[model samples]
Target: MPAICKLARQRLHWLGLSVCLLTLAPEAAHSQDMREVRRTVRYLTSRHLHGRGYTHHGDQRAAAFLARQFKSLGLVPFKSAAAYTQPFPLTVNTFPGRLAVTVDGHKLQPGQDFILAPESAGGRFTASVVYFDSLALGQEGARQQFLAQPLQAVALVLTQPDYQRIQAQPLLAQKLGEARALVILVPGKLTASLAPRQVAQPKLLVAAPAWPHAARQITLVLDACLQENYRTQNVLGYIPGTARLDSLLVVTAHYDHLGELGRHHFFPGANDNASGTSMLLQLARHLSQPSHRLRYTVVFIGFSGEEAGLLGSRYFTAHPLFPLDKVRFLLNLDLVGTGDTGATVVNGTLHPKEYQLLQQLNTGPASVGPLSARGRAANSDHFPFSEAGVPAFFLYTRGGIAAYHDVDDRAETLPLTRYNELFQLLSQFLTHLAH
Candidate 1:
């Protein structure tokens, strides 16, 4: 077995044993205290949250719920803002109209069989089909050769593992224009459950058609367009500092996830994000108390449009309430609910001092290790801040549960056994940073 997977499995076994012992022990009070984190995780990862994406009311509702929590925790706005919402604009494509696709005299049902590209220009075209295998590889030349043929027709592309490379190549679209060929993607056996009736934007590897003659009598009809004028907001809350207020410590987590595909499957995103957001809220509750004064102001940010590509954090850095230079450190929490064994801290190697401090705080007999550490990598909300020359770290737990980025990442399955320890470690780290 691979080393990482082996380590993960071993850790999982340890965590399972720990949970069993905790349940059997007479320390019900400790278990009950930990239930708060579990309950919050479940609530946020519930079906009602709709994956916390922009397509549904999930993002807005989550923002409101978080703002309420911030208010209850006594976190006031940093400046003149009335509330905790840091509104921003995001351009997104939405399917508000109709989509149609027809192949070889048969009309294909939307969402049931095929979906059009979001940027596709709606049109009806009768032409032959041309097959190009692996258009991103030597297929580019092969595609040119096919187009050079006397016949104009629909083009069938058999994409390989280089899906992103194919998508990036402008030659595909340019070839379609030159050959006047309609594009038909022959995706493998369409599983009813996984297939969308009408995909907002279809990007998938397709199998090559059986016969070359099958291309001669191809006809396709597609109706699709891009919507450009949509916007989303990120929620922000802060507790002002007392001494040396000019410096800042920011806590961030993305609250967005993949929205509902149709009606049935919602990527609950419990651990993908909602878990981290819950931790942020809990930490805000603890630190926002009047007694917890610090040298640097603490800003808690709940970013949106993260699944869409780190939009919220990018926007915040671009138009920061406090000068970006004044920001001393950003600690981004993500995927912390299921870390019964331990958690991994990204960018830990980049900031050895902070990493050592975290390890020291979590070094008790019952606590989980600092886990693995890696140098700076632009993977999450911490990316933008780090790019802007701010010291930042992305912290997440490792092992315990395997659920991630799927519907199974539900709140009910999260074992938040180490939450109190994690929180304590964070509190200590913040104190150390403050000094």
Candidate 2:
């Protein structure tokens, strides 16, 4: 019995060695491509790509580059019979030109001093300002007074508490949607998001009062475009399996982010998604190699319109090119630039066995720290797959610079703390999962 056990251990070790041998070139080539990752991130986040948004052909440029990479890696078409990219249409409100904001006759900075709301309807506005305590938004009398005056330009000076109160007032939202050129004075840095839908008015979020609230008028010299059916694409390619070719393992990452703030400053989404997309490409290159082919088919996807919502992933699931039931598992990667404290897995709790298996496989590779399991979040491209009942996990690195959806998330700053270890862990996990 002792001899048999030793023999078993010997065989398992040899098997592992064989697998590593087959994967050596692909794995090392991928690790060497961290330089490539940096290059790709820089290109995607560069000024010319315009933050990879729907405007200025930035998103399309990124799609073209990724498609070229896919072709170069010899990744075959999957789900699509015609091409590597799956085209889709979506509408987004974009501030493409003349984004100027003036308060009380003083022209303030565009990105530094204020942000135009995503739902804003574009056009120039010159109106006498009516200052209201954001606190008043909690009171019906105060809200009604502002809402009742249709032609009046309103400004709400918000403290954190005031902002909270205003959020509770549903009627205020209804009124604001109908109001034109509303000014909101917010404390701290200006953040932006893609509008879920367009509205009849534009809201300007300005930095809170600098020297008491004496501004009596507001002016916006803006040129915002509401792009309807803006054509964008999701890039996809696959490597067939030697055995279970029909069964699939999907790897995905969203390549979209908040594009440019006018023509001057682009939001470089390096950590937001460029990191993840670069990793996806690395994985693609590794799997595309014939020597490293798996027993189950693997698909690589670079999703667009993720910032607008999980539109691409949702569309893919709704109209999948392959059978959803044939899917063995789906792994969604995002914000993978840092892993000082290891990584977090969304939906890890929901699928304990697979999660446990991953952790088990992660035991030897101490470089990535430890894996953290988290509750499901709809904040990424994985949400749509989770909704469709496809077994999925969204993985993201947890530590390092806290650059999220902002301009600071540049390619030059990413440390890639444990990217190699993360890659190794996934490689091991997928091997075990496929087995």
Tens-place lDDT digits, model 1, residues 1-435: 267446534543543444344335423365554655565566566656666765556677677767766765667775744488877766544333334444556554443344333333444556555555564345657667744654343444433333344556675544444444334454443211111123322332223342233434545444433334335678887787888788889999888776553344456777778888877876776566556667778888999877667888998888887788988788998887767668888888988888887787777665665477888877789999999988898988887777665546677777665777777788778867877
lDDT of 2 by residue, 301-400 (tens): 8999999988889888887888888889999999999988889999999999999998877876454788889878898988998888889999999889
Model 2, residue 236: distance off in Å is 0.6
The worst-scoring run of ten residues by lDDT in candidate 1 lies at 189-198
lDDT of 2 at 372: 86
> Which runs in model 2 stand beyond 4 Å of their true positions?
1-31, 79-81, 138-164, 174-179, 209-213, 364-366
Clashes of each: 9, 0
**Quick one: best TM-score, which candidate?**
2
Clash count, candidate 1: 9
- TM-scores for every predicted model: 0.71, 0.86
